[model samples]
Target: MTIQILSLRKKDLDKIIEIENESFVNSWTINDYINEMTHNPFAYYLKLIDKDSQEIMGFVGFYIMFEHAEISKIAIAKKYRGYKLSKLLLTDVIKRISLANCENITLEVRVSNIVAINLYQKLGFEIINTRKKYYPDGEDAYLMNKNLREED
Candidate 1:
């Protein structure tokens, strides 16, 4: 399947919500996504689309504040999970942030999420800390970070 990365559009919210619900236990509300995509100056949300079918395969969202950025969300459709789509979306996000001169990027993953943690680690992220009860369901989170300067 041919895949293309595009900016998130207002019309894509419903599909994105569906993917989010499948991907996370504490999924974001529609208003939360709307606020970020429509009004947040620092945020940039992107979608990975299947070019031929026009279906959303995955998405990644982030916010850049001066020199630092935080990945807010990332998810692939349930059927698309094993294809490394999350890795592709993350790679795109890193490239976009680097072009914007971001110095650091960080994200939180559930402590029990080994697959995600391994992906981040493979992409050069380091486990920097842990947030107590970071998730709505009281799951602790591992805070991972990648500093752009280290790669250079």
Candidate 2:
């Protein structure tokens, strides 16, 4: 199955929300996505779709300001996990950000999400710091950063 990465559209939100709700304990609402897509100048969202089936496999959201980018969220459909699709999606995001002249990228991941932390680390993101009680449920988060210029 060929997967195509494309910009997130209003029509894609239902599937995106389905994946998001299943993937996270606290998921963003439709309104939250709408605001990001419509009102946030710095925000960029992308969705991966099966070219043959047209199924939404996963989605990622991020914001770019000046030379910095921060990943806000990323999720794969329940059936799509363990396929390294997240890595593929994020690698694409990094490439796009680099092409846009971003100097660095950062993201906050729950400390308990070892799988995601591993993936980020493999992608060259280093743990720069920790955020205490960063989540609504008071979970701590690890702040990871990757310097795009260093990869060059």
Question: What lDDT tens digits, residue by residue, belong to model 2 across residues 1-152?
Answer: 89999999999888888998999999888999999899999999999999999999999999999899999999889899999999999999999999999999999999999999999999999999999999999999999999999778
Q: Clash pairs of candidate 2?
A: none
**Which candidate ranks first by TM-score, i.e. highest?**
2
Off by over 4 Å in 1: none
lDDT of each: 0.91, 0.94
What's the true lDDT of residue 39 in model 2?
97
The 10-residue segment of model 2 with minimum total lDDT is 11-20
Compute the lDDT of residue 84 as modeled in candidate 1: 86
Tell me how candidate 2 scores on lDDT.
0.94
Clash count, candidate 1: 0
Q: How well is each residue in 11-93 modelled by candidate 1, as lDDT tens digits?
A: 99999999999988878888999988778999988999999999999998899999999998888898998998888889888
Clashes of each: 0, 0
Best by lDDT: 2
